[model samples]
Target chain A: MSDAAATLKSLPQSGGFNNSPLAQWVKANLFPNWWSTVITLVLTYFILKFLFGALSWSLFNAVWSIEGTDTEVCRELKGIGACWALIAEKHRFILFGTYPFQEHWRPALLIVVFLVLYGLSTVRALWNYWLGVVWAAGLLSIGILMWGGVFGLRFVEQERWGGLPITLMLATFGIALAFPLGILLALGRRSDMPAIKAICVAYIELIRGVPLISLLFMASVMLPLFLPEGLTIDKLLRAQIAIILFAAAYLAEVVRGGLQAIPKGQYEAADALGLSYWKKTGFIVLPQALKIVIPPLVNTFIGLFKDTSLVLIIGIYDLLNAAKTSTIEPKWQGFSIEAYVFVSIIYFVFCFAMSKYSQKIEAELSHTHKH
Target chain B: MASIPRSRPAPPSIKLSLSDPVVRAIVFQVLVVGGVALLVWYLVSNTMANMEARKIASGFGFLNREAGFAISEHSIDYSPADSYFRALVVGVLNTLIVAILGIILATILGTIIGIGRLAKNWLISQICSVYIEVMRNLPLALQLVFWYYAVILENLPSAREAHNPLPGVFVSSRGIMVPVPANDPTYGWMLIACLIGIVGTVLLSRWAKARQAATGQQFPMLRAAAGLILGLPLLAWLAGGAPTVLDWPELRGFNFQGGGTLTPEFAALLIGLVTYTAAFVAEIVRSGILAVSHGQTEASSALGLKRGLTLRLVILPQALRVIIPPMISQYLNITKNSSLAVLIGYPDLVSIANTTLNQTGQAIEGIGIIMMVYLTVSLSIAAFGNWYNKRIALTER
Candidate 1:
């Protein structure tokens, strides 16, 4: 420490900034020797200037209240910011799509249930078998909320269930169900049995080769042809199946990568102990392999979450579709930006949080592995 | 322990039981085969019943029938009067063109950005990082919409207010206009010369490198190749002197004329697919570079090689083996995601197939064709990628 101090003391600096060594050095070397400091300041100044202007125009100088004639109200706040009145008039359609106006609370309730599930899952203490019960109960409650007929409730058709909650439900259920299917497929692919391995590989590669939109289209349009004459499937159920199948294929690959990374010695050790195949896998291999795969698995989940928006192509009014529908309303025809921005922020929040959580899990797993 | 072994040795042949390995294997095989057969039989029966009831024919022969819808863009000759088969071909070609061009552009852009993220320059690195973060976080479909509706449609100058560069080039919301070459014998010869020059330059590079290594003499390979590839082509064109005239887009009332127009949907889909895939590619490249050990760099430096030389000679060769596999997937991803063009009406293969299915009520046939096309494309890419990977892999053992 003294040697470093002596070295620092021996170094000369320009006599400026009250003769503080660091400040004098910065002023002389950073400011004078490099143009980067000057360029950075200039760029920062312009960026901040633009940001402030946009903020002022979008918020401070904006029309807040829905009052007067449309043009007149906007004119009244001429120097003010954005006309948020369009959103006020059309926010319901954006939130609930073509669901009955009075029944908007049903979808709203469903959204709350979803939020609770998401919140609970984020807490480590709550991530247990009881939480599984909570999730199952919550899902049932949401279903009842959306489609009422039990316990003196009104019956709502699947067609009427639209907007953000439906999107989240499809993605969440798809991922949950796909997780087990993916694990089975991954194990089957790695199975010593040739028939099982071939079947698993074919299923995974066939599904992964095609785009989700095509699969969704097949599910929506052509699935009925493959069903028995008397059997009929709901459109939403078919879309859910497509989502599950697609997610499972991608997730299976991620899981397979993890399984391959587990050393052969683990399997040999399990065999040496005379454990049955199922016991060996269930008690030992899967836990360690899954820990290795948390990052990629989360990524696959995020991909599926974002991909739920493709349901809109088959006329399922998901969040983006709902937003589009809202923007097309005569009262809010030109405010598509605000509606899109709102939906994008919702998606960004979910996806960003998932990735950040995945990173955290990865760090923890690596830390544990090292010791 | 010895007594138990003697009991097994007493048997003339290996015994099989329900719990034994052979019986278990046979039972499992029979069960799997039976299950698959059952599924196939069920599906076939159901499909026949549905087709009989709906009176919808289920053969690919319908492809020969006329497809009456006009396509927005085509690289080859096509018309509304053409057969569904022809229309499908046009769609497939369009998909390939976009996928190939997008892959090339994405690779170039991704490598640059990936390296820039690791550069000593702080600004460049930060800018690249920010780009990756924002793009990777956003849903590609949303980015497509933003590019289409907000950036391209809102910001592009109208035809009346078109931005022009030089005499013949014009830019508008409609499309970019540049001089298109007309048919001429002399120009054809010049193109042939250019092709020859390209091949010659490649051969000359190999020869130059070999000579430099053998004789301890440096070769000006870049300059020589540049002269052969560019100068020869230019000289051939100059000798022939077949002047090509510019055919500028003229404003005919409201719309521009005399040049090809890129539809907004196509532009949006192309940009989105390339940018989204490029982000993944950039991450792959960054990881690939990191996978090359610092010891490799130190070793090169100790051998008195410059930084650039070390990177090109030692690092990139190692990094590429890591990079290529994931990069191939990213390419495949870009190709597959181009199917999103259906949402915005870009008329890709899936869009054309949808139209075909809707018009003919041939759901099974249309879907089968679509799946087959995608399967073929995927398998070909997988095969090529594997072969390329094998070539680049280090023989460490």
Candidate 2:
């Protein structure tokens, strides 16, 4: 009987996974908690129902490749599946709106170039300080390919450039130019001179307060008024400048957060070493501040990437605009869902990657700083 | 050393003139000032010349002229005959409406999603993660257009096939319709009571908080405050119940009459701004909650504080300080984004300004007012944010 008691006491608690009693209880009583179990069961039922319904509509019953009118086919498949014919016929317009049909490959190539450039930038081994070269080269190649005035390709006007390439260019060029401008503005705001600081503050505040739409409106309509006669600026250039200015304002604030976080002693130390203002800033202050702000900086970049779609408001045919224009065609009018879904997927992929990249960088930085 | 400065006084005299530090500082200040002044002067001269040659007059005088255009959404009584200045004010007010609404909705949704993201349930967190990731990455403009076209516009029944669910409510491809309040004189008093209730509740909440701090006892402040605010208004309404009447919408043929209708354009713009801003707010809230160290919560729990009470008293105050600044920027973003109303032809400030500029050939004046209005609104928001931030900021000894 003593041995039996000892054996009973020595036996391990079944299904014990966690040290905490609550965790252990949850593990042991998986579906034993009445309210939670009911909720789980209900949720599971609904989720499975939704999954099956979606599968039936989108996969099993969906028209995969029917070469006929969507109206007739979709009516037959009503309450059964998605009519995907709209996307099949109108995808070209959605991807490369109003571009010459024969020259669609140019924009297609531009997309590949952009992806490759971005892919290269993501890898730590390839992300050299001088990787600006790759971006510059990529931008040039994209511009030439899309605009096509140089090196045996037909000249395409800025007006004709549309779709994803425009969106990518706007974001890429905006960041490429705005980052340096933002750093300078941030430095100026933190400068000893009151005048420079005040000016920087005014500029940043003014640009940041207004929506990107207003700025685009101003760029498209009012920019010509501010320039000299016959020195006409391209609409694309005007939009680009506006985006750069607007992005710099927001980026400056992010960078300033980094600047504020750096210890004052570092500045004093650099000063104590008799380094000049530019020397100290270039070597000490900026590098540290930039490093500290990478996550937020990348956040801003991702934001700008998404925000580039606003140029469509000013009649610049960007990716969103292209998708919109595609949907309005008589044949594709009802296929709005397919077009939007396709574009949303593209945006999701790019955005998700960028966000993950930002997270990874943040984790690496935090880990290194801890040691 | 004894041989080297023999001419200098053993007890050195204090020299105030032209020290290296002073000289250097003076030179730097002068260079900076002079350079800025020069740049400003150049831009000014260039701008003046350009404006003069273009025959564009610059000033606030045109503001008093008749606007001659109707705005789609106006909070104030306005007409096409109203002054341009008043029209701009209408636009500004409209912008504020969108911003405020977006901020409130985003905050509630974002908080819920943020907490949901950290929930113990696997399904809840996974759903939240997908929502955040998907929404955060898509361009807000595209989303807005998609919502407008694919969801709202396409799904709605056509005008002839209108869905009238109630006597005073109508739904169709055009938009939703609901009864408007009868223009009653008692509304003025209702407005006054609302103001009083707001102020009284604020004061009472403060007093209650002070009382709680002075004593270890807790007050049911939220319930009490809610009663005071709502009950007072209800009492006022009952006392003057005979003063107002309902204005029910009536369906005339295929159209809804005698009720306010929400145009698809306005609905789309509002929806876009809210959803887009909500995504950012979700991330901000999640980060804010995560930022509060785990130890703080553990400590609160260790003291035998209830979960609700601990969240109300301890975690929230700290999280709020982190949350408000970003939330303010999101508000600004929403305000600015409402200008996208122009795309679908909602007569927002930018659209109105664009129309005015196009019509009167007063591009400079029209654009200037737009810029100034935006600048003012933006500055005010920033100022308010800074003030609120300072108020809730943690004090360190």
Candidate 3:
């Protein structure tokens, strides 16, 4: 028995090819058949080639930093390697736009405030009645910081504001203002009243049927035509209104989805309680409906955030515009790839974070609903 | 007027006051309608005042005037001397070209990626997931600019040194050029043959289904359909004398001459739109496929159907019911998002309209035309989706 035990221990483990889990996994997944093996080899070849190419171009061969818009190295690397030196040189201008280089700290600080507010909102526990107060205060600060004329801080005009802060402002204000209007529209769309429903349907469909670019074009050009003579709306403000209107229409549909998902019994229960229309919707219907739609609401916000880039077309210098112009200087002209990549990463970070958070909330919501 | 045996008037059940639901609803509707009309009236009056001040014409009469601007790419014959209406048509055609091609390509690529997301191969799945996430997260505007500036303009060689990855194809910073059939009447005949084949196939399939139900016998429908479609096209092409000559692009002076050209702007727009939309399409497809239960596969397999047959008859038909409604919306998204062609200087509807608006001071008319075209297209897509959804929806007694 002792001899047999020793022999067994000495022998190689049966059915273990090299005792490597990775090799076993590869065998099962990558090369289960001759056709699969061929695919595996081809895909591996191309993927490896691309991976190395991108890695070397972006990290290994790239010129990372240059002093004060200097030339030489970046110009030589041009196509072979990324010119990240341009990003370091023009990052401030790309982030803050033409908001007076000396007052850069103001936008920078406001960005910090925005971050803090976003962080606070991201926490699940803080999602209560106080959320409104936090947002109101946050937005008010944004306005004050942006147009500061008091407290020895210089006042920056709206036109001078651009880049990351402007993107943040548009997305934030767009969501903030649009959400209530969207709710109202959603309610109107679902109302028993025919005339009300018709008007709501027409407005929502009219806005949804066209691209946001058309509305921006309307805001930039035709909005003036709809204004009283000799009176003017600021370009940024007009764009903001367009964004709000566009977002409200889309959000209304999303909100209507939530409203539809609510059981008819809930509406009946509210009605049975002798609640007035406003009281019923406000206390009972809307709270439950809005909660069900939070994930999609976040998703809509992401779309709006990405869409803010389109403001560049109408000459509002948002982040994309700032990035585009960063490379317009003669020395930096050919280095748009770097600038775009930098801004894209910024956009990606914000959007990715929001999307991931939405996914998390969606999972939680489904889990709770299941329970 | 009190009739014989008329019951005493039912005790006034519903109060005729603001507290009553019906009364409140009517009041709300009237208030909303009045508010909307008042707003519209205010805007219209303001607009007229502003138009008078600016001396801007409001109607589409400008569409008849000479465009006085050249559209670099157009499917139909057009010139700088063409009317603005003709120019708009060119823009619309350009938009349709990109939108249709984008939809087709995005669907193909998206379906592959979507399937790959559930692949047994770990590396392939991971790669596909990464592609979807990265592409989906980035702003499409940023992607379009990246394609335009970074890929096309920055890296591509000049016209003389254009890369030719395939025979009769050339890619340069200026554009891509591919050979086209040299004025082929034979191709049109082939197209007509293909159409006939499609109709015949449909009829054959209907007869096969009826026969199968009647006699419990199966027909080789797939093989017959393929032959009728592909073989008939080939036969027509041969009968019409297959034209071998192609209008291959050639380097002459600075740019490629002859052949068909896809401008850098168009190519970039197509690439960006397709790539960006594919990510979302992939997610939709993945969800759709997942929505079909594993039990379905097992049930079909137990019934002794081959894998491919099971996929064709059982899996796809079910998955498509879930896939199609979302897919239609995505197609609509492509059409709408193609408006971004304005930025990269593609002569899409929006871009050309912007130019016309600038030249003629017809901003309102231009914007109205754009909205009307897009709204009609959007509504049509929605209607088609609704119809298709009804057709595919499961029915019961």
Candidate 4:
């Protein structure tokens, strides 16, 4: 009886050709039924076809070098695949539109510096009071680098600044300036003071109601009309301010959500400690509220990053606009698709990374706080 | 040694003081209000001076002037000779058209994809997730540009080489021309029949519900409603001398003439807005569905309800409560994002106002109108959402 049982047990788990985990997974996930199997097969066919087509187009037929070739070479391979040659040739113009070619290294260096600062800020170990100092120093340095006059570098005007650097500048500065304003607005909205509450509500609603494009238009056009005679704000500055105002409203709402989540006990305890309103908020409430809101804050940051593109409407030469302007060249006229795709990849990388970071933070926070 | 007892401090006089919370609050409010008032005063003075110096007339009076620029797409009758106000009205209508259509399309697509995300089919779920990720990650403006330039203009054939994918329908780089129904007299009757059928469906469903409550017997309400709606419309059309003639688009030398055409700009904007907003809507829907507790489903099933009936009767209604608030915001988002139609030269409100602003140099007035319109739209959606939410909200003591 024991021998028979052993033999039966050793019969490869009963089902034919389903002994392997791969087969088991396929059966369980892909082909649990006739309908599922049919769907899997059809989807697999189309997906594979698409993957192969994309691969062949992007890799096999794509022209990689434009060093020794011209537009004619790209034209020859036009219908077959993407003209990557166009990206290679005009990448400089696309990166630093209207900026003098000799000074390309400045913007390039600034981009790297800003990226490094961003990376540093993301490290949990770097979360301290000094981080604010670091950001301030970093932003100042970037400003000096972009505007150049103090350090004996040539003065490149704001008009000449473009590409990735400008995109980063607008987004980073907008968020940096907006964060404190957002916190204030959140507090004001929740405060017992009626006048303060009303103003905060109105400001938030007004900004939230309109599209960012309208604000950009208001900044670019109406802002000039509103300013004192002969007192001017640069197009970039006005756009930046508009972005700050718009982002602050959204951030305020998020912060308010975080604030509302804080327990009444926390407030009562702070009150019992004889803490003043400002001290109570700063020490007792805001830290915990802000901590709970980090994920949403990051999401807002990602949104602000994407929205920096809207500055293109008001004639700011951000990365997207730079790419677009590059494609306007006669030699690169037909390669807009390639240029846009490249720019899109850059944006996608930044946004995806930020979103992933937010997810990770959310997971970590939840894990630590598991009941 | 025994210590001498200290005398209680004398009560302080009740006086108006900054230390008092009530007095401090009043002071703070006055200060804030004063600051705001001063800021407003400064801004107005500066604006007035700037306007005077630049010789720029400010106000709504300029809206009466001729627009002097052509709008490519307009819902209402418009010409370059039309007043700026009329041009703006057309722009608002165009904006409304795109926003409404985008909201409808996005909701449908989003709901399907949202449900698809929860499907047991692995390939389908993965595809839906991928689509959501891609559409969400990209900026709406960039996507609009892509749809306009790459998808529509570059990939589509020119008018001369228009692709006739369907009979009486022509798609080209210029636009998509689809056969529309002729302005037949019978069409009015057919539409009226549809309205009647809809009313009948509602009454039928109500009666069925009441009967079920009283008799504990189920009715095939869906089939009956569908039959009424479809059959009545068909009968009306047939009775009114079925006007089957379609105004087919005919390809002239360089373009399709006749029939309704969806301009490339409109198409691109619609597609981009729908796809982008749908990603967000899908997430909202998924979360909303998930918010309907699993116990509810188990309980419904335990009561001998089938899967379809349980989902329809138990899950969806509860899920909709969680879904709607965010869904309204998404609708508002679609409306606002439709302003990006300017990027592709769609004559949306923002685009038309932008041109008006440029031509008339009435930037303040132009921006004011745009802001007011958007605010009105946002408020209206919020108010409607609030009403619906209140209606559907779970009531408890």
Encode model 1's per-residue lDDT on A11-122: one tens digit a residue.
7766755477776555544343235566556656876887798898678777666764454665455434566676676678777877888878888888888888888887
Candidate 2 chain B weakest lDDT stretch, 10 residues: B1-10
Q: Kindly report which residue stretches of model 3 are placed more than 4 angstroms away from their true locations once superposed.
A: A1-27, A30-38, A66-70, B1-15
lDDT of each: 0.81, 0.80, 0.90, 0.89
lDDT by residue (tens digit), candidate 3, B1-397: 1121134454456457774455666787788899999999999999999889888887889999999999988999999999999999999899889999999999999999999999987778989999998998889999999999878997789998999999999999999999998988899999999999999999999999999999999999999999999999999989988778889899999998999999999999999999999999999999999999999999999999999999998999999989998899899999999999998999999999999999999998999989998999899989988999999987878
Task: Please give me the DockQ of candidate 4 compared with the native complex.
Answer: 0.51
Interface RMSD of each: 4.7, 5.5, 4.6, 6.4
| Model 3 per-residue lDDT at B395 | 88
What lDDT score goes with residue A195 in model 1? 83
* Regions of model 4 farther than 4 Å from truth: A1-17, A67-69, B1-14, B199-220
Q: Candidate 1 regions off by >4 Å? A: A1-46, A49-57, A60-83, A124-127, B1-11, B119-124, B154-157, B163-171, B178-191, B201-221, B242-244
In model 1, what is the error at residue B275, expressed in angstroms? 2.5
Interface RMSD of 3: 4.6
Q: DockQ of candidate 1? A: 0.41
The residue pairs found clashing in candidate 1 are A61-A80, A61-A81, A62-A81
Arranged by TM-score with the best first, the candidates are 3, 4, 1, 2
Q: Which regions of candidate 2 are displaced past 4 Å?
A: A1-32, A49-83, B1-54, B163-169, B179-187, B206-220, B242-246
lDDT of 1 by residue, B232-342 (tens): 878887887846754556789877777555667777788888888787888899999999999999999999999999989999999999999988888788888888888
TM-score-wise, the better of 1 and 2 is 1
True contacts kept of each: 0.42, 0.58, 0.80, 0.72
List per-candidate RMSD values in Å.
4.5, 5.5, 4.5, 4.9
Q: Residue B87 error for model 1, in Å?
A: 0.9
lDDT of 1: 0.81
